[model samples]
Target chain A: MTRAALLLLADGRFPAGGHAHSGGAEAAVRAGLITDAASLEEFCRGRLHTSGLVAASLAAAAALGVDPGDLDAAADARTPSPALRAAARRLGRQLLRAARATWPCAGLDLLARRFPKGAHQPVVLGAVAQAAGLEPLDAAYCAAYESVGGPATATVRLLGLDPFDATGVLARLAPATDRVADRAVRAAREALDTGVDALPAASAPLLEISAEVHAARTGRLFAT
Target chain B: MHLHHPHDGHGHGAPAPSGAAARRPDGTRRALRLGLGGPVGSGKTATVAALCRELRSELSLAVVTNDIYTREDAEFLLREAVLPPERITAVETGACPHTAIRDDISANLEAVEDLEDAVGPLDLVLLESGGDNLTATFSRGLVDAQIFVIDVAGGDDIPRKGGPGVTTADLLVVNKTDLAPYVGSDLDRMAADAKAQRGHLPVVFQSLREEAGVDRVAAWVRERLAAWRA
Candidate 1:
């Protein structure tokens, strides 16, 4: 697997529509749940082990040639909020465009044709990793890191928190990110034998509920 | 680390077959995308409303408005009855309006593509950037052409300052010309400064409150469409 390809996918500037989203950090900040760097780390940790792990596993499974349709359904069942579900599909469509242009693979095109609107972002990310010639573990790392990285960057913007402290938060969480990715890849491999049910079902109800509330409100900065 | 890869012909080393103006997934040419960017209250949305009013009957057109906090711009277009609700879409910029249009255009691109898919075979797609600083400009990957709108009430010296949007836009529109005299702006000086800053690029001095309002800008858009088709 090409390590550089993994970096390219993981990069915040990949143009996959993550910038407009705060990964629920905007709502968290608004709720006073993530007020400072320390709180931000706490929030990221909770997210990394929950939604982050599930997203990473889905992406890893997609990289491992699992059926994206089934994985997308799995993602839907795991996500309780309709607002977050719509956001995922929207981001997924955007990523599909960028991935198709970046990877130029027939598999990506077929997925695009299949889910013209979008499948789910993690599902698409895993497929994108596959097209980019990366392994399942590489996809996991990309997904796991993004789950925290997106919020950290958004928190920097939302709270006007020190950018350096935000970077430090990410650095400190690097080891945890690795662990989540490892667990995610293991779950993905197990899914191949049993079923998608073998994958992790970790959940962060607050994030989901906050996303719904954020979507319902007006004058919010981030989309979700 | 190999910073480059075999697909380097495209973005991130993969040949990109499509972008702002590229063909749709079905191999049909996409709509002509024009961006309108300017400072706050400089009449960007007003200009979009006028253009839709002037051109909607003649050409298949849609609009995507990047609003920072709310759907005000999109809602205004819808309330104005300029276009049907479906044709007018709002993309939240997450308080960074410039980034959405210039830096990472993913959300805006998705809005545009979705518009085309839903009410498509469109001839033109107008993107209005949210009110931002003078330096904001649309990325080439986002728009085929761009118009920078500034009002005479804002300042005549704006042209002389010459930020990227004012200097490099395909068309520099000096809006609210009727208010120019009221605001004590020098029309001649603003025109001369625009010429100096833009060299040979076209500039339009207009007032939407006047007779045949938006005619000049509408004509310019028609010329652009003609060129796009040719």
Candidate 2:
């Protein structure tokens, strides 16, 4: 229940293997969907409402003690791209390794045993939050923020965009991120009674489709 | 990957415990993980290739390459057919090769573990970091030991300047000794600088063009494996 664990999990330097991924920003940049700070904003906004909302809701549900298996299936159902699904599970496996080491809870260990290959990333994220004694709102915030934050950081590297400007984009989206987190928490609350059907299932086709293209791409910097 | 398999065997055994655990989660002694790092054009990949060619016949080995953008390093090893394709893998660094090797090492860690799980009881795993700077060194958490490679043409001054890679790596390799004659790089001075900085740490001057170019490095690896097994 310590507040500091949230910061540890959210830190970009957490060593959870997030640095190698671009959150679909590379595909967007190569597709010319993001050339500067402005287009980057549009991309993030779209992601925050779509896939971002879905991931946050899933995480929030897991943190509220929803069954990880159900949340994982829900996550897969919401994601269209196989490449994105694989990446999510890969990230989930890595995060579980780190979370088990950091939080050392029975639930985290149980999740690892169940999904040896991996569960979905947001499902793992929520379970990790539960293991750390974090609330659903905190898990929702982490998922919502990372949904946009990963892309913002990657764009800084991809476009050589001004670092401050890229950060400014995150700052501008703070209000929107909060709204998404709040909505995600509400959805998670509904999910508690109605099963995973109550969780958000929003999808961003561009992100999913681009992730496939990105996975097939050679000579690309980021993994996805 | 046996997706339909029951709960326990879904992937490889648990990740090899991080740091220097002698045994994997599956309860077998793990390979000796080694890291190779240096500046671009310093022959890091060539050295890895050379080592693979020299050792493949006698040992069970694998390689994990960290590349900045492309899978060029992994592809190069594949094109060479050094080890079976399954024995080698690549971890993309997102343009920060050093971070994958040194700062945040989870990706590289997983690559090695996966390689071991797939084609294992491996005696050695050489992790070749993407070309980086003199300051770069593999995190101890990532690899058990590290070799820092610098060529004569990259400046004999590198060892004297003495960053962590030069001073602290388990082995300091001054590669391209044959090029020293033509590059006007003083090999003796480089050796002296390396000795001064490294003290008792081993340094091997290698010219991959030579007949037994990789022998000494291979011997160093053998010795490490012996010690690791001991």
Candidate 3:
């Protein structure tokens, strides 16, 4: 596997339909939870530790050859908001389309047959990592980065925040993201023997609640 | 690393394109995808509404609109009763109108695929980009052919300005021709500039106020459909 494929998958412009949804940043912005660079940084920090860690763990587990079906179920259980669940599945399906076209493999084909509609995005991300021949840590890193990176980018668009400030937010979170990735890999490794329950299931209640609220609002920019 | 992907031949329900504009997974012929892009208030939505009214009887059609607010144009079509609610969908572009149609088209692709899945055997699917600058154009992967709409009122000099949309679109439509005199836009100069920019490519001058304003565009679409079937 070309290790550089990780960069391709993790790139914000990878075209997996992430541009439309703001990773809950739109809701946060609308609710006045993220008013400036400092608030955005704090929001990113919270997400990196919670949802980021959980998503990274699931992706790492999937990359480590865990059953995607079980991981998908675990993801469903972890995501409390119906809106979030729908967004996750929609993103998963979109990613699968790009993945199957980008990296055609028997495994991805089976995934398409299994969840013709979709699975959770992290489950698909792990599957994509496996198809790309990336290591579990790489999958963890990809998911961990996406968790904060998406929100940071979206906050920039939503608030018209300085692009450099947003990039700085991602830069500040990188070290923490690395730690999250490492912890996720550890959890995924533990899950290999102990089962997926051993994986991180950290929750961010506000993100979930705001997501449900965002989905209900008709006049909005982001999907969730 | 080798990125040579072999056709495993299991593309059932695959959303991306292959044998493009050719056939669906069920072995039925797919609809021709046409794109309409232009600047703000340049009559992109009006043209779409007119196209729907003119062609809906003879052709089965659907629309996918990309916009910052996301639903206004789609809602406009719905309010006008251009097509059933199910046939029209909106894609959020996060205010980057061009990205949805050009840079990363996955969302738009899925929108069209979903439309086809829900109400299918469509003769055409028109993907309308949110109003943007002249640089915005549809990715070939997203649409079979594209029409770039400019209006006499926006600027008579837009064709001479000649960006990608003006030069490369399969069809360049200079809309609001009736407003030319009112807006001080020279019709002859605009036509000449369009001809110089597009050469052999087609351009249509339209005014929705006319008795059969959309007929020319409708005829062009029908010709494209016949050619696609051929």
lDDT of 3 by residue, B1-230 (tens): 11112432235554333224356666576788999998999999999999999889888999999977658899999999999999999988876889989988878888887888899978899999999999999988788889899999998999999999999998898898989999999999999999999999999999998887888988888888787777
All models, RMSD in angstroms: 4.3, 4.5, 3.1
Highest TM-score: give the candidate number.
2
How good is the docking of model 3, as DockQ?
0.56
Output the worst ten-in-a-row residue range by lDDT, candidate 3 chain A: A215-224
For candidate 1, what is the DockQ-based docking class? Answer: acceptable
TM-score of chain A of each: 0.99, 0.98, 0.99
- Indicate the worst ten consecutive residues by lDDT in candidate 1 chain A: A101-110
> Candidate 3 chain B, which ten residues in sequence have the lowest lDDT sum?
B1-10
Residue A56 lDDT (model 1) = 98
lDDT of 3 at B107: 82
Scored by Cα lDDT, where does model 3 land?
Answer: 0.88
What is the lDDT of every predicted structure here? 0.89, 0.88, 0.88
DockQ per candidate? 0.39, 0.56, 0.56
Superposed by TM-score, candidate 3 places the C-alpha of residue A43 at a distance from the truth, in angstroms, of 0.4
* C-alpha TM-score for every candidate: 0.94, 0.96, 0.95
